[model samples]
Target: MAQTTAVSSTHRLWIGAQAWALRRLSAFSRAPRTAPHLETGTRGEREALFHLRRLGYTIVAHRWRTPKLRGDVDLVAGHGHTLCIVEVKTRTRRDAVPAELAVDPDKQRILRRLARAYLHRLPPRAREAPVRFDVISIYLESSPTSTPAPSIQLNIELNQGAFGWA
Candidate 1:
């Protein structure tokens, strides 16, 4: 009986070690890949935030999403009496499509719907404010390699009122 008890204890220890190793392996596999394209997009969003601040726009939310909503508003800001819903686009020089051209009519329609949903969640003071959609396009220089530390040049363009609520 004592031998059987010892064997059972050893079995439990082995199973625990296996589970711990599996969890570690899964976490390592799920680590985010620092791909250049993704990095460029993140950098563009940061640039847009800085630009908006410099222009005296008060940012109310970043990447705001509602539980029941299908889409998210990248940046919700206010400048004086108008509230702005911003969409950010990032592209490298090697990309065939221009950033501005990427936001087609369908995309605009989706953004407008998202903005409406966002407004519904705001207080009456903000809900009644006039709203507009803006697009920020960032063009980056093509890098020679996919190295994570490559230096790149960025040209940012702000298109205010790119689309309207109506």
Candidate 2:
């Protein structure tokens, strides 16, 4: 009888441990959805990263911002002999305005200033490399509900040397 009780206690402890582990795993796996704009931006950046990698650009920084600088660069990527400062714009089908239109002349000026700051901080080798401004626009479309997992179709456009230093 004592042996049976000991085995039952051990079994209960094992079950309890399993339940705890499962809870932790679920918490880890399930990331809460962010606000629509934030989610769109994150998804755009991710897609941009993949696209840049495929084109053989090494990513140097993401969302690079400094307290001294007034603006941020979405991505800093390096190709063979050039450095690219990228701005990422994401828009859902519901958005009336196109993504590229958002980067106006004012925004281009800010990006140029930020790029200067970024270059100043880089090592001599990278600083000496030619710099180009790029814009990556991603249009997102929601998938039909019949699919098991929610998905988005992305239409990406990469504009290289979209703007130049002033």
Q: Count the backbone clashes (under 3 Å) in each candidate.
A: 0, 0
Candidate 1, residues 56-121: lDDT per residue as tens digits?
A: 677889888887757677889887678889999887774666687778898888888888888888
> Each candidate: what lDDT?
0.74, 0.77
The list of candidate 1 runs beyond 4 A from truth reads 1-31, 94-97, 142-150
Q: Model 2, residue 3: what's the lDDT?
A: 9
Best by TM-score: 2
User: Could you tell me how far off, in angstroms, the CA of residue 55 lies in candidate 2 after the best superposition?
Assistant: 1.2
Candidate 2, residues 1-166: lDDT per residue as tens digits?
Answer: 0001123445556555654575457446558867868966876787677666656677889999989868789999886678889999988774667787789999999998888888888888768888888898988887777879666677888888887887
Off by over 4 Å in 2: 1-33, 94-97, 145-150
**Residue-level error in angstroms, candidate 1, position 160:** 0.5
For all predictions, the C-alpha RMSD in Å is 18.3, 16.2
Query: The CA-based lDDT of model 1 is what?
Result: 0.74
- Candidate 1 RMSD computed on C-alpha atoms after optimal superposition onto the true structure: 18.3
